[model samples]
Target: MTTAAGRTLHAGALLPELIAVRGIAAVAIVCAHALSMATRGHGGVPPSVEYARLIVDFFFIQSGFVLAHVYDRTWREGRFHYLTFLGKRLARLWPLHVVTLLVVAALVLAGRAAGLETENPHTLWSFAVTFLMLHSTWATSDLAWNWPSWSVSAEWCAYLAIPLFFLAADRVRGSAARIAVGLGLFVACAAFSELVLGADIVTLTYDGGAFRIIPSFFAGMLLRRMFDDEPALVAMSPRGYAATVGGVLAACAALIAMNATYDALWPLMVVLTAALASRAAQPKPGLLRGRALAWLGELSYAIYMTHAIVLQVTFTSAKLLGIGHTFPQRAALGFAALIATAVVAQAAYTLVEKPGRSLMARLLSQPRPARAFAAAADRTGAGR
Candidate 1:
């Protein structure tokens, strides 16, 4: 779908800034994961781990926002190209993914060659699972692949459902009816998750991280629709912003008090964020709309896709230097790893993902020239 003004509303006017915040969420999740590994005992989680888990809810919310942006733009434009849209997504996401998968396989083969670990059925099975991107990050099993990749499974699932959303919204006609259907589909999907997986399975927890994230993803779709609705259902009115701030504090308290037990309140984080985005998406949010955050947002996918590998390489190198696992030691190690991850992710983005995106952009673009990537995104947003 292409926008006539060459400006398709993303995250309903918070496109770049919202994506910038996604960078912060990626950093938070990776650091929290690494720090929790240092802090948790063999059998149980520390209180800090609970804090870490809630942060993932932020990721789910962010995913929903992007998906909605994609779907709405596609439906509104009336000219979404299926092949080009999916192709762009593949170019943007799959290059790193397929490369990392092969890299893991190569590393495993090398580990076996060096006698670090023996090849066995269980080991081979672990490789097979991760090759499919199903290996859980928190599972006790010694496995491979990008350890943070369970979300990719969630991402692809959302991709599959997007066409269905586009059809419902575009074909269903009346605005209220289209919205009702979208919300209905979102709830039905959520109900299916609860019924099939149990209520506790909502926040991408346990095995839910593998598949149960559809609800959160769709909740994002619904919220995105709400953001675009004519009446401005969730725009940042002064009172609405105040309530969102209050709700965030409450969500934090519940997250802490529940000790990572509550996955149900995850949608609230998106609601709160959309309120803030309502403000930022307005005419003047100044530095929030600056170049740095947008650059970070552009690189955010690389940071997410590469950070775990960076953490492993950083840790493996540190281990070679005989670093210990003391609290302060691990904290310093984590800090160093974050810095290293940022540098490597930037390099990877420049060398791999960015160029791949550019090639796809040029090839799949409308034959006529467009002014910028926003116009390009507007052209290909349906497929994106």
Candidate 2:
């Protein structure tokens, strides 16, 4: 059930499990995109090429749950100053985002300079939306910039909403209300997907439908609330805990069997992520541990931001060079490009991503806003 920390345990210690999972999930995401690239110019809807994106779905849900797992630690010492929270997120995201954007822009400009002929229509408008992170809506359309960006926007929104979600849960009378609110958010996301992305129940696509992703964040928020409330349920024996985790795995397999697929499967991914997080957070690690996973987690931001650009550049350059005969051959070349990209991504994380983020924080985080809950820690500290 519960651990020495009083928080319910799930699987083999929480922190290591989560860190391991994040790394695995990142690899899965890479695999999914690789599968997508093996096909024609674009990828969507085909059991093999299409369904791989479920990995990214897992990634999103993981984002929410991990955020919740760490939220208590941060807020325990301070109030929720909106500015600080937003600033920290910027510090986390903006550096990679801006640098990757500019680099992509530079490449595209370079291609244009070489008369490679690409597109950047609605230049001012697209640039503004991207700068503001409103580019998330592109998930609902044929447009995507630096392509993988949609998830970053969604992750940002989820972080901004987590505090409010926690506040809502703190004020709610029971788990039912909090869960209902989480479900309501899911329903809203579905409705948004239906209306904006126009995804019919009959059609399945890898479309970046924004509505489909909300369930991940909602699931995370719900789990955060549940963590605060369910110490008894969490304190089960190790065998029982293993069964519970097995059930979650079985449920995920069942979803695949049901052919729910991608947009249709977001809700399940949300639930899965929550369970995984609850289990993973059980065994918190000491500082400076899990160096490799932590490094991946850190470079994760850069990898995500730059991978799309890398893929596009690789593909377009290959096309321009008239390289490769068969899809399989090009696929091999693509793998090489991905490896090169990983190296570049790491460098970008260090040289550009980290620095750019720091610079933005310096710019956006000054003149700290005044708020009651903005203290460094919670006034009424409640440990699990």
Candidate 3:
């Protein structure tokens, strides 16, 4: 590989801004869950937290873009191994998913045994299905054990379809065509969800979330293609970058002001992603590149995986202690839950996620006894 004058492939691969966005999304979802927990029997939560659910779409889109950026060139060069790619992804996702799933199961079982009512459906069959990462496709209920894991199940679906999405997008030539195809997929999926499923794409989780992830994931891959074709999108001056992001924000706000549907916000999301990505690509100061934010990004998956359990514990304890009723009490409880969520997420990341990934990497690195498979693995650099 011929290298660029100033950029290493590893450096180009890292997107601090997007990572920061992931951190923000993780925190937002935690907040939304916290509000829900606190307001279990109280008055309705604020409208803003209700809309936080849309950030899941952002995760789907970001996953597509980042994975494509990392592996597309290898695939195009005939050096991509599907199994190895899948293994690496599983290493990233499965450890924490299993941990959170078990934690939720124990909580539910203990609560039931103690004669306390639990809201989420946590049946044995559902647990087994979720353990296999098939909950999104196989479940009968929406909010089954560890409800947030639904997105992870949907993500597994996207990972399985990576080769297909890449091949499909690869055949479409030109930036405009790629954009059209990407948007078309998103719109088509949204349309099907509205017409047949009778739900907005954003609201589709557990039962119908696979449909939601497909288009968003494909669109994200397209966006990565466009960015590769024109890396200069990230070369804007500071003032220009600020103006571009501000304009996108204004457009998003206008959509909200008009009571526009969720589908209408899709393009703005794409634009905003591009803008932030561009700014992050630069060496200059940018909106989402601080140390704390980057750390949050690194801990994002842990936060997402563990927050539901932490919130459940927090709320349950609060209820037992007879708090979270009045406005001040709810606010304080929500704030406390948020802090505890972050602390627990950090622990999960340190204890479970990092070690599991390292172990998987080491296992994948061990020499294969089968000569033919080893040869193919070598050609593909899949062992790395």
- Top candidate on lDDT is 3
Where model 1 places Cα greater than 4 Å from the true spot, the runs are 1-14, 40-45, 118-143, 168-195, 202-210, 233-243, 258-260, 360-384
Tell me the whole-model lDDT of each prediction, alpha carbons only.
Answer: 0.62, 0.62, 0.80
TM-score of each: 0.75, 0.77, 0.90
lDDT (tens digit, per residue) of candidate 2 on 175-219: 777677766766676676678767632122225434345665556
For each predicted model, how many residue pairs clash, with residues at least 3 apart or on different chains?
Answer: 1, 21, 0
Q: 140 in model 2: Cα distance from truth in Å?
A: 9.9
List residue ranges in candidate 2 displaced over 4 A: 1-14, 41-45, 71-78, 119-122, 138-142, 158-167, 195-197, 200-213, 232-250, 261-264, 284-291, 362-384
List ranges where model 3 is wrong by over 4 Å.
1-12, 367-384
Stretch of 10 with least lDDT, candidate 2: 200-209
lDDT of 3 by residue, 1-384 (tens): 222233222323678888998999899899888877677667677564566776898888888888887888888899889989988888888888888888888888888898887766678888898997878774657578888888998999889988898899889877889888888888888889889988898888877777789888888888877776664565555787788779987986777777678788787777777777666666655558788999999999999888878777877787788876686787788889899888998999999999988887777766677976878878889656
TM-score of candidate 2 to 2 decimals: 0.77
